[model samples]
Target: MSRVATRPVTLPNGLQLQTGERCVADLGRMVDPTVYKNPEQFDGYRFVRMRGTPGLDAQAHLVSTSPEHIGFGHGKHACPGRFFAGNELKIALAHIIMKYDWQLTPGYKHRWEEYGFGWSSDGMAKLLMKRRDSPEMDIDNF
Candidate 1:
């Protein structure tokens, strides 16, 4: 017999699920233009600007569990590692930015590919990177 995962419930988006059924939140819809300016365009500082937002707090770091940030999972099933993972990501990215110059490979066009309920980076996309001779600040020093 199959295990019943949950009781019937209605999601915020108005979708209903019966007992034992499963569903993944549609995060893409949350970031649509209705919720963000020029949502289709890339803005690296988007989260930076969003940090400390009254409701979002530090979750703008990009991984957290909430009704609107369910990508990190939800409720008791929510990812326990999200906080550590987010900090680890920040440290890694800081090192990359301070120790190297990077950019997309010139003339290489990239596009996101959507499959079913998710999207993936183009397999052919390329990035160019070169280590800096002198770093802006040593990350390990403090």
Candidate 2:
């Protein structure tokens, strides 16, 4: 969602310019072959490897989006509550996985909405989930 504009100037190739709005996309960097190996694949451990890499900052985790991965945006414009949001999401996911049996609806296929800038999932995917326990469940087990 970053907004940028170029300075009014002339180019060496004899192109004229006027100051106007421009789009600065970080999505390209997220899947750049030069920055990430097997960029097309959805590897959850991608950032884990990056964190373990020698000479890299250990504190810079997957949730800490940067120019390389702008899921939460970058720099000063990044999500201010990302850390809290990430932790809450992790806790909720852990609870669901530990206490439920879940699966996607049979023959279900994901559909994404395409746009000029990017794409997003249709958000109508179906899932079947049930509680693992018949009686009272113990939170301590989780």
Number of the top TM-score candidate: 1
Off by over 4 Å in 1: 1-22, 52-63
RMSD of each: 4.7, 5.0
TM per candidate comes to: 0.69, 0.68
What is candidate 2's local distance difference test score? 0.73
Residue-level lDDT tens digits of model 2 in 1-142? 5554567766567865568845455588767899888987778887777787885554357467667778887778789888888998987877787778899899998777876567766667889999886423555565
lDDT of model 2, residue 8: 70
Local accuracy of candidate 1 as per-residue lDDT tens digits, 28-70: 6556786667876789887788785786565576775565456
| lDDT for residue 138 in candidate 1, whole number 0-100 | 88
Least lDDT summed over 10 consecutive residues: which range in candidate 2? 133-142
Stretches of candidate 2 off by over 4 Å are 2-24, 56-60, 134-142
- How much is 120 displaced in model 2, in angstroms? 2.3
**Backbone collisions counted per model:** 0, 0
TM-score of 2: 0.68
- The lDDT of each candidate is 0.75, 0.73
Relative to the unseen true structure, what is the C-alpha lDDT of residue 140 in candidate 2, on a scale of 0 to 100? 51
